[model samples]
Target: MATYEDSKSPEGPSSYPISHTISASDESNTNMPSWDSDDDPKNPYNWPTSRKWALTCLAAFATFLTMMNGTMATVAHFEISEVFNISETSFPHSYWIVTTWALGGACSALFILPLAEDFGTRPVFLSTYLVFLCFLVPQAVAQNYATLVVTRFFAGGCAAILANTAAGVAGNVWSTEWSRSVPVSLYILGYMAGSSMGPVMGAAIFQSLGWRWIGYMQLIWFAALFPVYYFFFHETRGSAILTQQGKSKDKGNDSVGSEKTATTSTSSLRNLTASATRPMILFCTEPVLFVSTLWSAFTIGTLFLFTQSVEQVFMEIYDWSVTQTGFVQCAIVIGECIGWSLNFLSRKLYLTSTSRNTEVPGAPIPEARLYMAVFGGVFGISGGMFTYAWTSYPHIPWIAPAISLTMVGAGSVLVVSGVTDYVVDAYSHYAGSAMGAVATGENIFSAFLPLATFSMYNNLGLNWASTMLAFISLVLSLVPTLMFVWGKEVRARSTFMNEMTEDGSKRSDDMV
Candidate 1:
C-alpha cells in the first residue's frame, strides 16, 4: 500500500507521493488545507496513541478476514470439485477455484487503490466490503461451477481493498519511520495468520457442515463486520481528510482551491490514468523495484502453492485426513510468529543505524532493512524447502516436514515485511507506485503458481518438484545481500530517483 499526497509541485503536473512530511513552514504559503497546527486534533498523526492503535488493529483484523477468505477454500477443494463434477485428473482448471480469488484481487487492486485515493479510505472500505459480502452470498448458493468461479472473482475483487489499503492506513497513522514498523508488522502478522489458519478452520467447517458452509461462514463474518466498519472506521488518508475539512470550512474560498481546480474531468482522467499506469511503469523501469518485487512475489507464490502441496504430501505419505492435514498447517503460523519476533531486532538495528548516520541526521540507511530478508531468504525459505523436500517419506517422522514448514513461514514473514519496509523507505516519495508494483506481482504469482502445483508434483514427483522450487528460492535469496552491497549505487543510477530529487529541489526553491 502507498500513502498519497494531494499537493502538486509548482513546476510540473500533480503527482501523488507516498509520504509527505513537509513542515508547516514549508507549506505556509501554499493554497492547500493542512493541519491547523502540529497538535491539531483533526490530524490522524496527532491522535491519541490508544486511538491510533485501535484503528491499526481494526485495519489488521480486516486484512486477516480478507486473507482467510482467500485460502479457506483450499481444504474444501475436494468437496467443491466433487460438487461441481470437476474431474479429479484436471491439471489446473479445477484449481482455478482457488486461483481466481487472487487473480481477482490482482486485477481489481489497480482501480481500487486509485478509488480509495480519490474518495477516501472509509467510504471505499465500507462500500467495497458491502459488495464483497453480497458476492459471498452467491458463492454459497451457486448453481454451477461457472457461477461459483465468477462470484469468487468479484468477491475477491471487492476484498482486495482490505488487504492492500491497510498498509496505507498504517502509513497515515504512523508518520515517523521508526514507529511505523510496529503497525506494519501487525498488519503482516494478521495477513500471515489468516492465510495459515484458513485451511485449518475451513477443514473443521467442511467436516461439520460441508463445503458450502465455507462460503456461508465468510458471509456471516463479513456481514457482521460491515456495521462495525460503517460506524467506527474513520477516514485516515491525510489528504482526503484535509479536503473534507476545506469543504466544510468554506468550499468557495478555502485552501483546497488548487485541488478543486484539478477536479476538472480532464484532470481527473489524467490522474486516474497515471495512478493506474505508474506502478507498471516503475516495475518495468526500476531495477531495484523489479528485483525486490520479483523476490517478494516468488516467496508469496510459494506460500500459496504450499496450500495444495502440503495437503497432498501429508495425505498421501502419512495417510492424514483433511482435518489432520489442515491442523498441520499451523506449523507455518508458528514460523510466522517467530519471524515476527525477529523483526524487533531488525527495528533496533534500523534505529541504531539511523542514529549513527550523523552526516544526514534523519536519513536512515534503507539497506539496514534488508538484514532480516537475507536471513529469511537463506535460512528460512531455502533451508525449509530443502528440509521439507527431503524428509517427506512414509518411514520418516511427519514432524520433520512440519518443522520445515515452520521455517518457511518464518522466512516468508521476514522477507515480505523487510522488502516492504525497505521499499517504503527507499522510495518514500513514490512509495505508492513501488508498493503497488510489488503488490501486483505478489498477487499475480500467488494466483498463478498453484496452478502448476498438481502438474509439477505429478510429472516430476514430490521431492524433485519441491527441490526445483527450493533451488529457485535459494538463488533469489541473494537479492537482499546484493541490495545491501550495491543498493545505493543502484538508486543513484535510477531514473526515478533522479527525477524525484529534482522534483524535491524544485519544490524547495519554489517554497523559498
Candidate 2:
C-alpha cells in the first residue's frame, strides 16, 4: 500500500521521481512489487471514509473502555473498604488499588509500544485486550483484597496500550495536520468521558447490585467489542506492510533476498531497542517532551486525584447519596462535551491559520496546536480550580462546585489534545515514542496523587487543598504559553525530532 504521506501529498507535481511510474518493461524487472502508485487502492489513507470512521470509532471505544475499567472501582471505594475491613489508619490501602493500576500503566508505556512497532499493532492490540479480559474474572471473584489488587495491576498493565496507542492509530488514519484535530478530539472525549462516567455507572451498580458487578460489566462490554475489532481493523503500520511486501517478493526473486533479509532484521532490532529507550531519554533530554509531559502529567494526575476525592466531598459536604454524587460527576462529561465543541472552533482557527502553508509539505507550525491549550489552561483549568476551591462551602449550592468541575474537565481535554497534536507534529514518524514518554510521566504522577489527596485535605482542608491545586495549575499554565511563543526554537534543538523528519522524508521519497 502507498504510505499515508502519499495520500496527503499532492499527486502530480509535488510527488517527484515516483518509482512505480516506471515503464511496463522496466516494472517487470523490478525486485519487489509495491503499490502501483500513490493512489494505491489498498492504502488505508485511500480507504473509503466509512471504513476510516469505523476503524476510528473502534479505536476510540477501546480507549473509553480502558478508562472505564480503570475507574470502575472508584465509586465502589466505600464498599471495598468495608469488604476488606480497612481502617482509617490503613486508608492508603484502599487507594493502593488505584495506585497499582497506574503503576502498571506507567510500566507498560516503557515496553508495549516497542513491541507493537517490532511485531505489528494488530496482534499486540488483540493480545493486550484479551489479557485484560482474563484478569477481570479474578478481580470480580477474588477471595481476598490481595488477589483483587494484584489482578487490577495486571489489567491496568494490559489496558495501558489503549491509552498510549490509540493516538498512534489516529495518526495512522489521518495524514494531514488539519485532518487530525477532530479525530484526536473524539479520542480525548472517549478517554475523559469514560473516566468521568465510569464512577457514575459504578456508583449505580455498586449501590444496586454490588461492587462485583462492575468487573462483570467491563468484561461484558469488552467481550462485545473484541470481535468487532479483530475482524474489521486492518493493519496500518507502514513498515510492517513493507516487510510483508518484501517477504512476498522473496519467493519469486532471489537477487535481492539476502540484502533485504539483513536490512529488515537489523532495522527491526534497532527500532525495537530505540522504541524501548527513546521515551525515557526524551523525558530527560527534550525540552518540549519534558515540559509538555509535566503539564500533561499534572492535568491528568489532578483528574485522577479528583476521581478519588470528588465522591468523598459530595457525600460529606452536601450530605448526598452515592447516586446523587454519581449524578454530580456527570459535570465532567458535560465539560468534555463542551471541550469537544470548542475543539471544532479551534480546528477552524488552525485550518484558517495554516491554509497557505499546507502546500508546503512538512512545514505546519507546531505552535498552532497550542493556542487552544492556552485558552484552556488559563480559563478552563486555573479558573475552574479556583472556582471549585472557593465555592465548596457546606452552605454553598451544589451547583457552584459542579459548574467549576466543568472547567476542569474542559481544560484537561484541551491540554491533552493540544500537547498530543503538538508532539505528533513535531516528531512526525517517531510520534509513538514521544507520546509514550508523555504517557509515562502522566501515569506515574497520577499513581501518586491519590496518596497525597487525603493528607492534603486533612492537613489543608477541602477549600485550601483545592486552592493549592489551583495555584499549581496557575504555575503550570505557562507551559502552553511558553511553547506557543518559543516552540520553534525547542524543536530546532531536538536531535530526535530532526532525525525523524530526515527519516520520514527519506521514506516518503523511497515509497514514491
Candidate 3:
C-alpha cells in the first residue's frame, strides 16, 4: 500500500521484494499511498459523484457501441443480400456482414493500444465512435456489395478501436481496487444483450420498416453517445494525469530546474512511451498477461463458436423457427448476466473491511479472483459441452441444447471476466497493450472460429465436433486454475511484472 512505486529503490542484484498481507480496506493512515480519492483531490478515485458516474456511463456506452456495432449486421444480413442483389447459401459470405467489422476491429487492436498513451484514452475513444458511425452512412446509402464491404471494413476498424479501448477506459477511471473488470463485465452484459437485442430490434424494424432502419437506429444511438463521451470519461493515465496536475501545482512555486519539473513535451513523450512500449512489452515479455490473454481469447472464441454452433443442432434436430433461434440465444444472456453479477458481488465483497485480509492474503494476486474462474469456468465449459454434445441427437428434447447454451454462456463469462480482471489489475498502467494482446487475439479467434466450425461439425458430426470444442475449452479452463495454484511463482518469474513493481517488492495494490 505504500505506493505501486516505492520511493526507495532496491540496492541488490534484482532480488524479489517482500510481500505483505496489507489490510485492503483500513485505508486510514495505513502507510498506503493514494489509497482513497479523499486523499488526493485530483486523483480519479476522488472525483465527485457526478463525475464518477459520468465516466462509468461513458465506459459502459463505449463498450456498448463497440458491441452493438459488432453484432448488428447479423440481423441486417437479409436486408444486405436484397440490397446488394447477391445470392449465396454460404453463411460465411453472409456472415461477412458481421465478420468484416469483426476482422477490422481485430486488426485495429494491435495499434490502438500504444496510441492510448500519447493521445490520452478519451480522445482515442470518442474519435473511434465517430469514425464507425460515419462509415455507416455510406453503407446505408451504398449501391453495391463492394461499397458495403469497404464501408464495413473501415467502420469495423472504428468498432475495433472502441472495443479494444474498453480496458483502457476502465483502467483510466478506476484504481486497482476500483478496477475495470466488473464494469467490463457489465459492459459485456450490455454487449451480449445488444447482440441479442440488435437482431430483435432489427427484426422488428425490418418488419415495421426495412433493414436500412437497422443502420439508422445505430446511427442515432452513436450520435447521442458521441457527445456524452467527449464531455465526460476523464483521463485515467496515472503518470500523465498526475504529471500534468503536478506541473500546474508547481508553476511559479518551484524553480524551473527541479528534477520533477519539465515541459509539456517531456510529459507527452513519457506518456507516449508508457502507452506504446509497456503494453507491447507486457504482451511480449510478461507471462501472466500473455497466458491470461490467451485464456481469454480461447474462451471468447469457443463462446462465440457456440453462438453459431447452436443453430446447427437446433435446425437439424428440432427444426426451430428463426424466432426460436433468437430466443435460444437468450440463454447465453441469462448465463452471462448471472456469472457477471456473481463476480461483481465478489469484487464488492473484497472491497469491504471484514472481507479484505480474511480472504486472499494477497491483495491483487491472480489467485484473488480465481474463485469463479476455476470453480465456474472449468466445470461450466466441460459441463455445457458435455450436455450440449450428448443431448443434440434427434431423439433429444430441444430444451437440452438451450440449457447447454446457458452453461456455455456462464462458463465464458467466468473465464473472460476472471482473466480480464487479473490483467486490468496486474497491468494497470499498460492496460492497452495487455488488453490489446487479449482483444487482438480475442477478435481474431472469434473471427476465424466459424470458418472451421462448419467443416468440423460436418466432418465429425454435431456430437463429435461439439465434443472437440468442449475438449479444447476444458483444457483452456485449466489455465486459471493453474494460475491460481502457481500464479505467485509465475509472477515471481515474470520479467515485466517484477519490473513494474516499484519497490522491487510485491504489493496487493500492484498485483490487482
Q: Highest TM-score: which candidate?
A: 1
For all predicted structures, in order, the TM-scores are: 0.89, 0.86, 0.77
TM-score of candidate 2 to 2 decimals? 0.86
C-alpha-based local distance difference test score of model 1: 0.73
Candidate 2 on 1-512: residue-level lDDT in tens? 11223333322100000001101111122333455567776655576788778877877777787877777687777777788886656355677787889888877766654555544457778887788889988878877889888888888888777554554455565655445446656777887787777777878777888888888877888888888888986666544454476577567677678776676576656665766776688788887788888888888888778775686678779888766777678898889789888887766555454443332344334466678877888889889989998888899999999999999999888877777766755665455566677777877887898788887877788888888888888778775677655655666677866644443443333222
**How does candidate 1 fare on TM-score?**
0.89
lDDT of 1 by residue, 1-512 (tens): 11222222211111111122221112232545667776677777777899888888898898888888888878877777888888867575666766788888877775655556656667777878878888889778887999888878887777677665654566677655445667778888887777787887888888899888988988887888778887878878776777677677865675556556555345557656776788899898988888888999998888888888998899989999987888899899899999999989877776566555432444445577788788898899999999999998999999999999999999999898888767755665566667778877888898899888988988888798889988888888885687666766776788666443333322222211
Compared with the true structure, all predictions reach lDDT values of: 0.73, 0.68, 0.58
Model 3: worst 10 consecutive residues (lDDT sum): 11-20
Ranking by TM-score: 1, 2, 3
The candidate 2 region of ten consecutive residues with least summed lDDT is: 13-22
Shift of residue 264 alpha carbon in model 2, Å: 3.8
Q: What is the lDDT of candidate 3?
A: 0.58
Candidate 3 lDDT at 200 equals 44
